[model samples]
Target: MAANALLKTQSPTFASPNSALDNIVLEYSISYFLIDLLHYLIFFPTDILFILHHLATLYVFLTCRYIIHHGAFAFFMLLILAEVTSLCQNIWTLAGFRRADLPAAAKLYEFLSPPFYALYTLVRGILGPLLVYKMVVFYLSGVAENLIPRWAWVSWMFVIITAILVSIVWVFDHWVDWFKGRNYKAAKKVV
Candidate 1:
C-alpha cells in the first residue's frame, strides 16, 4: 500500500510544468527582493562584526605570538573561517526561505538543525585538510607575510575554485536534465 502511494506520488503525470515554473519564478523573485533588503540592512552590521573580529584576531596574533603556538594559531584561523562561513550560510538560508525555495531552504535547514548539523561538521572537517594543504603549498611558495599562514590563503583559493567548478557542473547537469525532460530525483520526490 505504501509502495503504491509512493509510486503515485512519484509519478511524473502529477507534475505540472507551468506550476513548477511559476513556483521557481515566484521564489526567486521573493528571495532576490528580501536578500537585497537584508544585504543593505542586516548584513551591514554582520559585516562590521566580522571585520572587527578579524582585525582583533590579527592584532592578537601579531602582538601575542609568544602566547599562541602553531597549533593554536591554526585552530584560531579555523575558528575565524567557521564563523565567517556560518554567517554567510545563514544569509543564504534566509534568502532561500524568504524566496520560498523549498529545496534550497530545506537543505540549509537540515544543515543547521541540531539533529543533523552536517554543514558545521563538514566545514570544520574540511578545515583540517585545507590547513594542511595550504601549509605545504605556502611553505613551498615562500610567502608568509600575513597573520594567517600562506597555507590558509592557498586553502581559500582552492575553496573558491572548487565552488565555481561545482556551481558550473550543477548548472550544466540541470540544463541536461531540462533538455531531456526528466524530473530530477528530488523534484520527483516532491510530487
Candidate 2:
C-alpha cells in the first residue's frame, strides 16, 4: 500500500494505463484469491455471496492483468478505493465476535462502527452506482478496447454489474437499521 500510494503521488499514469503488472494489483489479486480459498473451505454455504464476490474480483484482476489490456488505471483506482476501509471492517467484525467478554474491545468497536458505516455507504453505496454508470459508458464507448476474449470481457462486466446490484440492495437494507441505532449486532453475519 505504501508503494501504491507512493506511485500514485510520484508517478501519474492517468493518460496511459500501464500494461505492466502493478505491485498493488498483484498483491490484491493474491489476497483475494487466498480469501476466496479460505472462505470456500471454511464457510462454504454460510458466506456464499462473499465467496462469489471474492471469486469474481479475482477473476476480474487476473483477466485485467493477463488478458484485457484496457482500463488498468481505472481498475486499480477502483480497487484501491474499494479496499480503503477493509481494515476497519475486519476489526469491526472481529470485535463483534469477541466483544461479549471484552469491554474495551466492545467500546472500541462501538466508537469505530459509525465511521465504518459512513465509509461503507460512501464507497460501496454511492460510488458503486457511479461505477455502474461508468461501466455502461465505457461499454458503449468501446468494449473492444479491452482486447480480451469476448467471453472474458462479457463475464467480467456481468460480475461487476451483479456486484453493484448486490451492493445497492445491501446498502438499502442496512441504512435504515444503521440510522435506527440497531447495528449489525443482531444482523446476518457477512463473513
Candidate 3:
C-alpha cells in the first residue's frame, strides 16, 4: 500500500488503473463479506447492524469492481486502510471462540484483546473517515471526478453513512465498558 501511495504521486494521471492486487482484494472482500452476512442471519440474528454493514460492504465492492472502476487507485488505498485491522480482528474473533480454560489459549486471547481493540479503533474508526474524505474530497476534486459516476458516489455516501451509524452503535454496546475502565472478565460465551 505504501508503494501504491508512491505510485499515486508518480502516475502521470495522479491515480493509476486498478491493479491485479486490487481485484484480488476486492474478490476476497466480496466473498468474505457475503459469507459473514449469511452467517449473521443464523448465528448472530441480533447483530442486525453488522448484517447491514456486510451488505453495504458487498454493495460497494461489487459496484467498484465491475460497474465503476475509476479512481481505483485512491479507492484501493482506502481498502488497504480497511485491511490494517484484519489480522487483529481475525485473531481476536478466532481466539475468543477457543476454550480459555486451556492456559495457552487463555493467554493468547488475553494478549490479543487490547491490541485488537486499539487497532480496530484506529483503523476502522479513524482511517475509515480518512477514506471517505479522500474519496469525496481528493478523488472527486481531482481529474478522476468523472471516473466515478454521480449515482455511484451517492451509493457510496449511503454505505459510508450506514457504516458510521453502525460503528457508533457497536462502540456503545460493546466497547464503552472497556473505555470506562471496567474490569475484564473472559466472555463465558463467544460470538
Please, what are the lDDT tens digits per residue for candidate 1 over residues 1-191?
Answer: 21222233321221111133333333343344355545545656556534443443343333223322222333244445455455656765475465455766666654444322344434544554475456456545654433335454454445444443443454356446444543566677788
For TM-score, the strongest prediction is 2
Candidate 3, after superposition: displacement of residue 144 in Å? 3.4
Q: Count backbone overlaps in model 3.
A: 0
Give the lowest summed-lDDT range of ten residues in model 1.
10-19
Say which prediction, candidate 2 or candidate 3, comes out ahead on TM-score: 2
Between candidates 1 and 2, the one scoring higher on TM-score is 2
Model 1 C-alpha lDDT versus the unseen true structure: 0.42
Backbone-clash count (model 1): 1
TM-score of 1: 0.24
Provide C-alpha RMSD values for all models, in order: 21.9, 6.1, 5.6
Pairs that collide in candidate 3 are none
